[model samples]
Target: MQANIRHQVSPYLVFFLIYNSQVGVGILSFQRTIAAKAGYDAWIGVLAAGCIVQVFIWVMYKLLGKANGDIIDVHTNIFGNVLGKFISFFIMIYYWLASVSVLIAFIEIIQVWMFPTMPSWILSTLILFSVYYCVSGGFRVIVGMSFLSFIFPQILIIVLFIFPLKIAHFSNLLPIMNHSFMDMADSIKSSIYSIAGTEALLMYYPFIRDPKASKKFAHLGVLFTTFLYTISTIVSFTFFSENQLKTTIWPELSLTKTVTLSFLERFEYLYISMYLIIICALIALFLWCSSRGLKKIFNRKQKYTLLLLCLLSVILCHFNGSFKDMLNKYIIQMNLWIFYCYIPILLLVLSFIKRGKQNDE
Candidate 1:
């Protein structure tokens, strides 16, 4: 049966999914990682890395769009038959495993920060069900949910600035760039870390209504998300001291704790709830893309493909050592490799062959 490629998503909706997916739980932890390397200068690394990511996004879009297909299709066309299928299989595994690791990390964060007493199985079940629900509806619905979640969570972030009005310690951001250029470059790595979801644009390209607008939408999404990351990091640092910031795991939550209103006490709870929605969308979207990759590689039906992959991912999530251990050992390291080494080389090979074929033509 032919795949259902209807219900095209708008540029705005695409932007929302890309931004929200990239901004997932990483923002909460990244400040410390970046800060540790560059100190107060980490924000600079983030902005610089944001610019570099835009270039990577452009290269990705051009290469993937040349195939007018998903990553699997792109790989197959460039590599051909056996070698192509083998490569596609590796790509599919990489994508699915990455999604599982992120989902597991989200559950672990919720357990530690939001609900210490909650069972891990229960949390994982809820997340899996939510992801399945979104995945079943397809990419357009998933993107719509992303737009909704982005607005509310961002509004809460805007409200958070009010806390910095009184509690902010501007001195914490001093000694700027005290670290060497290499150190700043090192700091920027974490920013690039969370920027994973923008690669979704490749799988998502087929769903865009106006193909001409695809590249513009993706770049704008990157810019907007980078702005959000910078502002949020700046505000978080302003509100907490260097010593306090270093000690804190999730400084964004710490930034929210200063918020007090007549109705609510702990704002982080609301933040966590909204955040889970974005995280769920990210996992669902990634899983959907990975399923698409599998279908292209094996030539299978989408429905059956997704079902099988989802089951496999659910099992993988459960069997993990722990989300943190998985991230530290495998996920974080592997993700960088996927983007920087795997993707770039793949694109370069495609570009060279495509040009050679054009010359022959």
Candidate 2:
């Protein structure tokens, strides 16, 4: 059930893969979204959500580790091939649509900031071309892209947070926990969706060279991203007044506006450009999961499946005038329920089934 040795990656790379998957276009605007319900207390909600994600990570590892393969294997072993693939088809489609959602969100950013007149198809096609190239090279290549995404932009982006801190109104976060428990719950809910993509680990479990050894690295990866997000939420909360943050979109990108250099007066442009690495890496990983799942389910060639997905993604983006909002909403709900709710139930059921089989044997 394990992937071939040549196709597997080092255990440590789990950190970068988790990092790449979690950090995407959501980071750009999540502050305002989380703040809407809980006011300044939303950062605490973010930490809470991260805790939930850590628990979910533990669940996924336990489930996938027992199967010793991807979710597809888990499904087939439990449900028989037909019904298992029937259920798994929904998850695969979720992966493909998740990639498209990221694609459209980033494309919207490019249109607004970088290219006002550029067509959606052109941008979608351009980005997917890079994603296809990386993904077609196989899982190792996708992980390589993830590693590059982590190394190149992350440290520099963290340094950029200093610019906003210079003028940050730290008192804006005073009188914390002012929001009601209900409001805090709302904020945590929003934060959970924003910090999603860790569930991508389920599909790629077998590709880890030593899945057991990688468990700590996987938890470490989520721990790192949780802190990254909490720090980002704190920075955004301090830098913008409650009212101002509510009004602004892309507050993280706005923070970059404070960053000025002798060579570069417009740093947000560079910020968006650098984000291509993070965004493309995410798209590549999601599509790899989607296409690989489909290949296994249908016994079809992976290349054909991947190419069809890229084409469908492009077509969806081109016609995305009204569908964008709906797409995001659907994917958000799907990520929350499927990964958080149904996945845990699945783990429970799988444990019972495996135990019963062992007793029978």
lDDT of 1 by residue, 122-228 (tens): 77777878788888887777887788777777788788777776867778788676789888888888778866677776676777776567678778888988998
Worst 10 residues of 2 by lDDT: 154-163
Per-residue error (Å), model 2, residue 244: 0.9
TM per candidate comes to 0.92, 0.98
Model 2 agreement with the true structure over 160-238: per-residue lDDT tens digits = 7988899988899999878799999999999998989998998999899999999899889999999999999999999
On TM-score, the candidate that comes out on top is: 2
**Candidate with best lDDT:** 2
lDDT, candidate 2, at 131: 93
**TM-score between candidate 1 and the true structure:** 0.92
